[model samples]
Target: MFLTHGMNESGELVSVADVKSGHTNLHCPFCSEKLIARKGAIKEHHFAHAGETCMESKSTIQQTGLPFYDIATGIGKSDIKLLDKFQRYDNVWLSQKQAETAMYLTQGGLLEPSPNKPEKYQLTRLGRDLVKHHDSLLQKKIILPEATLQEQLFPARLAMLQYHDEMNGTQAARFYQLRLQALLNQHLYVLKIHLQQGSTCFPLIKVGITSRSELALRISEIKRDLQQHGEVLSIEIAGLYRHFGSLERLIHKRFRASQFVIGSHTEYFHAIETAHDLSLLNLEALGKRTVEGAYCRTTYREHAHKVRVGQRKAKLLNNTHLGRPAKNAENLLTDHPDIVEAFHASLSLRKANTKTGKAINTVRKVYAALKESGNT
Candidate 1:
């Protein structure tokens, strides 16, 4: 239904939505509607069904582990054993879904807690596929957590000292916080947020880690810094590294899969959004959608990962009047001896229609340029 965003006492922005990191079944937050219709009359959102409940208000978010829930739903294809990666996020977690969603978001945005529930947390799903793939595919690709880094970060005091010696207190804190990321990338536990509130007034941030020793030392530092300066409110270490990546895959694949979940939840969650934007639900409009992705040259520089060779890529190729010439045109032509002949042949076949002709001509010119440059 509606999207909700607000600032906490700490001034950090918080957003609430049906599709938020902690939510399942992308409903209209306000009305609990499965669909939303933005009211042009006012900025606020409403349900597609006028009489239904609207989105959840700022204070209404239930404390249940929801991200974990979403992950479980999407995990239809992954292994069941993979659920262990999420245990670190919530010691009391009892469901498969919460852990899965939590794992997904931890990689996308930094996970944080509801001030109301300091022990619980939510984050962006950076690498979210371990739970979404079919068992065969999931089982074939997975990795386990690294124990060494976990040990290194285990000693809070030591890490604190290294952090201090390696960087200033501020920088040390930052580095210590980031230490969990290494484990996370490897599909180990992720850092959980420990929510603590203070009354002082210094710029501060919350950090999370896996080890108690490390957490203890880091918390002590924050407390000490605030007490000494008498200028900052107490900062919190709300969470620590729970398990990372898809555990089911790791167990099945024996940690041999790729390091990312581009096709996992991260991919699909994004796909749900992007598919709608790129898709033409109307069968009649399929060509339009295809054309949009393809010939929509407006964004020639889409992210390397985002732009796969889809019909859109082909459409773009079809619409192009100019080929993207090779950097070393001469060398390309020389290296590929058939380039000149192909270009000439292609050029001769060009029709007069702008759309198809443009593409053919583009190929012709690009190769021609290369041939001429190569001879130079």
Candidate 2:
């Protein structure tokens, strides 16, 4: 007899759809014998035992302690109708007959009271999963012998368990786990904020790690501390990685040259100077390890071009410097004549201060001196 489900080396149930039409590393869930995948064009896909089938594979037994089987057999037509109706609507007010069926399903952990309204009902996670995989469940039932209803129904439970196991192995799943290990145990956050230094307002990028659960509260604390230095124009989250402290360290190391101190904090970097780091962050977000591909190179080029264009616009509109702050008026006027020209062209200082990039104090002083000396 052909089986629709087989167990892999991990002891997780796998469907015939998961493998190709060849001898697979799959064992019969009932007899623990090697199985062959049959995926011919004419017939339905299934798994057959490589050797003679065992007695258990041929006969049907009343299997207990299987949630999927119990749920599938226990629910009546009315219960299924109610579940389908709830799936279509966000919240449902069941009729008296439907309500009776829903009450039974609720006790069986399929339905729950809606969060928004206590009187209304909603499908639980298990109910949603059943609804989502309804067709697949029916297919499994159709392939199995009529007597082996338990075998047919139990595959859904096994498949769901396998899915849960796979998800637990993912990076996202590891992120949510509160582990005692030091590595990959904190959230890495890239924060962008405009820092006002004298007459200059420039964008400062902060790369740091935190173990806190409430990120909003942490951001609020940061805003409060930074408010004394600047107006705290906007505190935007540029990048976020759960349990990525090592990556945070790598980012800090990459842009160490651009690092600057603001009060007691030292994780800050000049936004324009370290704009290339954006590409790295973008790649990491996309789950790419290497920047060797044409796509990655294009991403780098795009970021560089955007930084250059932003620098030019910042200088023109706000007289903001790009790389670093100028120490003296001679250097400010000599290096960036365009910035001085913009201020002398009657650009409002308030408007200039609104933009963020680099130092603007020296540019302001140079503009004032030039205006007073009638050198404009």
Candidate 3:
């Protein structure tokens, strides 16, 4: 998950991207140690503790106390009873935030506090119905027989063979390995948000990914950020994927020119289009193309390219320094369609052992030479 906020040496909340290597010392709010700002191009920028343990992981669970699940459980019990039951499974100590969360649950009608006891509570009818529905879902039984050890060990290979009848031996093995990786790396989500109608001068679009459990908290954080600029009407779960890191990097690379850096943190690509265009960014569309393929196979490639180019052109024209024309200046050559495309292609190739670093350096050298010659 990306770190939206971190404490700098001055004890001020700052974005991870703003933390410079030597000058700007940042710390994890949870551990209070030097924060590791991972700025890899293929991964989202996030802050982490160098080696020390982060209390945020433990403290968050303590503070929230499984509120979603607790609210879902029919609460025909006293507050003491509920607390005892929760403590038995979760932890011995409940934070003040967890207690407040329980009170809020009552206010939300998920619980009904007794007037007599004050501490006692009962589940509202709606809450009871929800509990029943959840239980029924859990009660569902799978008819498939239990798997043998051999079958369990080779489940992916079997699944690959079952799904890809035309696969050769080598192809089936490769597919199975990829499928296994995808299964092991679960819950990579691509989330999106659009500004509510009539909230701001122009509707804003936000896209991001999180491989964390506290998605609700993340959404709230983003909502709070967006609310500062405009009234947010809704935040939606755009897509969920398995093996999503590569896909996310691909999208970010594709829309690099269109990225909107709010508060110096870059993650959102400004989607300047009608609601219909935003509608196209759904689960089906994200999952349509091959996970490893760039632009061409993607459903939104054309749209994304158009937006990226438009944003780059607009930026170049708007910024006086960049827009200034010199007879022999070759700086604008970097923005040539071929060069820009190649740059993005190089970004995609920057994985594992690859000569991408050399290629990118060569491109940079060409740009430098051009600019130096123009100056001469």
**Global lDDT scores for all candidate models:** 0.32, 0.57, 0.45
Candidate 1, residues 1-376: lDDT per residue as tens digits?
1333323344322222212233223343333444333433234222242244433332132211112211223222232243333323454463676554444333323234545676665322322232222223422211112121122223322233343334333333322223222223321122122222355222222222222324565456445533443433334432233332212222222212222122111111122222222222111111111112101111222333344455456658885333354346555455544445555454343442232334554456555675565532
Question: Could you tell which candidate, 1 or 3, scores higher by TM-score?
Answer: 3
- Can you tell me which runs of candidate 1 are displaced by over 4 Å? 1-63, 69-137, 140-302, 305-323, 327-376
Quote each prediction's TM-score. 0.19, 0.29, 0.28
Report residue 79 deviation for candidate 2 (angstroms): 66
Q: How far is candidate 3 from the true structure (C-alpha RMSD, Å)?
A: 27.5
The residue pairs found clashing in candidate 2 are: 318-352
For residues 194-244, write the lDDT of model 2, one tens digit per residue. Answer: 877678888889887665644797789788978877777778887775544
Cα error, residue 199 of model 1, in Å, equals 47
Error of 3 at 306 (Å): 32
Candidate 3 per-residue lDDT over residues 31-123, each given as its tens digit: 677767766546556666677656653443222221121122222234435434432343334468556545544554545665665565555
